[model samples]
Target: MPARPPARPVPPAPPPSPRDRLLAEAMRLFGERGVDAVTTREICAAAGVNPGAIHYHFGDKDGLYREVLRLPVAELDRQLAGFDDPGLSLHESIRRFIQPFLFDDGSCNAQLFFREMQAPSPVFMETVAREVGPLFDRFARLLARHAGMEQPNAAIHQLAMGLQAMAHDYSMTRPMLDAFHPELLADDPLLEQTCHRLADWGCALVEFERQRHASR
Candidate 1:
């Protein structure tokens, strides 16, 4: 038998940099446990980097957590940014806002965001101003139009917040919802039906409020 040719040397895989490693591990840990429960030492250990790397890269542990929390909100903002067509109806607007959270496909870690909402920090407010507020403002305007209200009124503002709260409940209560309402998790058709139902539910409330104001 002929001798085999010399074996080729395989290229070594490039290791993730300290910053990237810290970010990945931070998100994983934060998702598993809320931000308050995680420590910088654990994050560095999980990422296989020096403890000081957190400060060097992100200024401190809080900064790192802020960055972690910021990730999904930024994604959500990008997802909703394109929903600016003037022709969108109230139900369509509500559906679009709710779509990103429900059928996320792991693009944005909805659990991480929900955790932040459960235990809010300064980062939560910062994220709101930076990424979330504008999206809500857009929804508020659309909601006002559908509700037959003037811009920036107390009614419209309250209604917009209520609409968002409804969407959040749908996203955060999935485990319980799945147990109680199997059809919602079974297929896209049922899921969409649920979404339409939710949107119509919101529109009905808005219409009622609008009519109430008109009657006064």
Candidate 2:
């Protein structure tokens, strides 16, 4: 038999760009500690980049923060890409809408979001309302369809927000889960089960609303 040739060495991966590094570190810092507590210099130091890199890439710390905040919203938007389709079944629509929040990526995005919700800065509130409002409105519209309403009312919006919060708790309350019931986040199967349960609950809520609306 012919001798086997030696395997070639694999090339090393390239280093992250300054911009990428800044965004990553800023996300971590801002997520763990509120945006007000995190400093640009600290982020630059953690990212191993010069402070000016933030200025060069994002114009300023506020710009960098805005970009970082958008990352998770972008992921949710991608997950929700056909969420508003009238053809989708109610169960499937609820599943798709809440699935993104079922798993934690171990990033600070969820933390940051919840933190902003608790005691939001003016800038954070403005950015989040502008970016996230349309997504919430879409979900409310889907809920309205399930409830047989022509359009979403304030009650429908409240229900939509509550359902979303239920999903958000799975990811955002990791520490509490770890301390209380670690099994909930122990595996993919469990997460999927939770997602399905939440979807069922959402359907039930919609049905209740539909019956109530019909009675009027």
Candidate 3:
């Protein structure tokens, strides 16, 4: 073989700009502690940016908080919308709805939403209405159809909330669940089993409610 010349070195990647850094750190801190509890200084420090970076990039702390709140919901909405196919069965719909939050490990949106639920800010309800409410309504409609209900009644709302809680509780309680029962965290199989149980319970509960309402 002929001798080859040495290759040139590749340049290093550029650091994240202050705006992007600020947004990322703000989202993380706000997820860990509510916006009311986290300060601009802390976010700036975490991002390795100056204190003025928040004002420069986001206008103010509240502005950043609002962005942080909206970012996760927007992503989750995007993910759930992919499952809106009319042909999806009830169980499949439920799986797609919960899969992103429970199984997809790349995004911190689920943790952020859990934190928002724990200590909501002033814009919580508004954010939910704009970004998350439609998804919940879609799930409710699916549940109602699967359970053989025609109208939007109290039972539908309750079943929707039940399913939502079942899906959300896994993310919120995962740390505790892991600590107490590490076996559950051994691998993906356990998590899949847990999701199946949640789906089963949610489906059964909806049917039970349907029966109860029918007898009344």
Give me candidate 2's TM-score against the actual structure. 0.85
Better of 1 and 2 by lDDT: 2
Q: In candidate 3, which residue pairs get closer than 3 Å at backbone N, Cα or C atoms, i.e. clash?
A: none
| Candidate 3 error regions (>4 Å) | 1-14, 48-50, 103-112, 178-190, 213-216
Best by TM-score: 2
| Maximum-lDDT candidate | 2
Select the stronger candidate by lDDT from 1 and 3: 1
| Candidate 3 local lDDT, 1-216, one digit each (tens) | 988989989999998898888889877776666677888999999999988988987788877877777776777778888564779766777777776556535345555666667777677777778778888888787777777777657778877877777666676677788799888768754378777767777767877877877798
lDDT of 2 by residue, 1-216 (tens): 999999999999999988888988888899899998988889999999887988999998889988988888788788889977889899999998988877767767877877888998877877778888899999999999889999998889999999988998887676787789767657754478889899999999999999999999
Q: After superposition, how far is residue 160 of candidate 1 from its true place, in Å?
A: 1.9
Count of clashing pairs, candidate 2: 0
Query: Compared to the true structure, candidate 3 yields what TM-score?
Result: 0.77
For each candidate, what is the lDDT?
0.77, 0.86, 0.75
